[model samples]
Target: MAHWFHRNPLKATAPVSFNYYGVAGSPAANKICNDLRTTRARLLDMFTDITCTPEVMKNATDAYFSLLQSFIVSPDGSTQDNKMRFIQNFKWTDTLQGNAPRHVAQQDMVFELVSMAFNVALWYTKFASRLAGKENITEPEAKDVHRSLKVAAGIFMNLKEMHIPRLITPAEKGRDLEPRVMDTYIIQCQAEAQEVTIARAIELKHKATLIAALAYETANFYQKADHTLNTLEPECSSKWRKYLQLKQHFYMAYAYCYHGQTLLAGDKCGEAIRSLQEAEKCYARAESLCKEYRQTKGPGSTAKPSEQLFFIKLGGLIKNTLEKCQRENGFIYFHKVPAEPPTLELKASYGLAEPVPFELPSLSEQCTPEVYATFDLTRGAKNDKAKPKEEEVKPVKEPDLKPQKDTGCSIS
Candidate 1:
């Protein structure tokens, strides 16, 4: 008899858990929470329909992209391209109702709109990455990369400097927007946006700008997020901490890859090797934390199927990215060293595999090479043949970091 998945008693998959809830007894917060819950359910349904109804998948994806594109072109997200757009296009500025302004509600939609753009960008970016450097990279994949980058850039430009609406206060009541404290949401959006920006920067050979942006974000988020987490209440605190830590480690790994790549772009092989080693260390930490935080829930608990898949795929992606980075940086190693966090005990998680060996293409050769080939930023060197090379950066040794006891680096 042929053996199936169930036949192999030794093969077991671990469960993952997730939950999100609004502040208890607060109507305003409750409504927003309900809206978010509905949104998550609806999006998952749409995705499922697309999967089952393959005949309409392309049409659905196109419509989805168009909706995303409409918002991308309009940073304010005040325009209404589709009736089904997440944010309702309300036009009642300066009108007052009892105590609050009528338009006050609209101010908060910026976060939601930016979030929508971020998700769409993430989806297409993954699609593009899967197809990248493949033997059969079709027009669809190339188009996905182009559209994804556009969305990512749009999200960054729109939200990079945005402030958190002072609407969400620590107390039950609202307060005036604070100017001093950084907006955690925007910081996160911008951090994710850097993935696309860094790739584009490498393609354009602007190593200085890429390194500067990555370094700034990594440091900024670590300091700010660490401070925010210290002030959180007990309820949902651990959940949110896990969420933020995931992003923090991701940014660290991301920075390491580009830092190494920038060195390689300048022919600093030794430095690039060291930077990649740091990246591997970061990835291992992230992998362990990811599995630990989302470890299997006990019986009778419910989590969305789509959400689970996303987390699983994300775990795989980090491993894949690290493997690619190491190969590209010319690192030769035997076994992939698994770095465990000091806090997490050995635990099982979904979709994490040992980093497989693969050949990564040159930085410029991967995605949309024509984007760089057809463009000239310099005034005098408009001709293709006279294109200037980026100035080679000298190799510099980064001071090795001592093992620190506190690993609670994250943004709110």
Candidate 2:
């Protein structure tokens, strides 16, 4: 643990000690001093446990030396002053003056330190693995770990900044305040955070199918709204139609891309390439339609900023899919074929004079007898006109027939 701390000095500080400057004899001062002592004790205990391992000792020593060097080169006060100056220059007086709340800042600092430690550990681990002749971790695996850490950090940061009690108001002694009290900002932020958390969780769990389904549902809802607006307001039909088309295409493309990625994972390169190509085409069409819609709206028209962001996101997805395909040596070519005109052929008998003029039948008269008899039977008859003689028929003998009697019941 000390080795870890030494490698990352930021991690050495207790969470509560961040920005805990206290006046003498103040409660804050006491709290900070106690926290510092506890942190030191924990580090000392961890250091003692690794005393038998020389390699661990050397790592710890290096970490300590690096941290000491950092302190000697640039002290904490100097770093704080620089940060203060930067924030002040940006007119972030509230943050500088401690009015932004210590917990939020501390949480952010803690997350930053943890992030740094993770990266350092990752580098060290990779080096060690290489020396040990172990299989190397893949880029995607590394990315997944990093993403998980970041998401965890985000959750912690949110927890630190959240003020549940403050956001809720007590009802008056005789009246209900639930209807009147509302923290719209907090509610919106929480809702968005939940969405992000759920999405990230799904990704981490490898429930990509679920994620795709959710995305499809969201897109469909938006498309339905667009359709509803168009139906209710005919004058804005064109705008809504474009909006609906863009959303439908974007979602469908996103779904295709997700499925393509799954195929790529399964080593179906050809199928993946085709799916990704189709997805790219869909996204490109969506972007073009969005641009056209914006242009049609004219200058000074207040268009939603999200429309442009959607295009940007879709473009990024397309580029990523293409890059992935290229990296895997999976590429496909689409060719355009030109249409050829129909050819007509005519056949004539050599013995016959140039075919007699024939009238084309009208649609109603197409199946008439005149059309059916166009090929005269007499023309193909044999050239000989001799008559044949008929033969006389002889009578044949017939056998005699006998009748039989049937018995009947008297009761009938």
Top-scoring candidate (lDDT): 1
Per-residue C-alpha lDDT of model 2 across residues 1-412, encoded as one tens digit per residue = 0000001011122222222122212453334334433543343233324122324533443433332222112232243311111110000001011112111122232222222232223233222212212123333433333333333233223322432122223222211111111121112122222223323434354454454454455345445545443433233235434555565666656656666666667766556666677778777877776676555431112233233333356567767885776667534433221132111111211111111121111212122223222323234323224322322211111112121121110011
Q: Please give the clash total of every predicted structure, in order.
A: 3, 0
- CA-only RMSD, every prediction: 23.2, 45.9
Worst 10 residues of 1 by lDDT: 1-10
Per-residue accuracy of model 1 over 165-227 as CA lDDT, tens digit each: 322322111111222112333333334334334334433546543553454364355446545
lDDT of each: 0.35, 0.33
Query: Which structure among the candidates has the greatest TM-score?
Result: 1
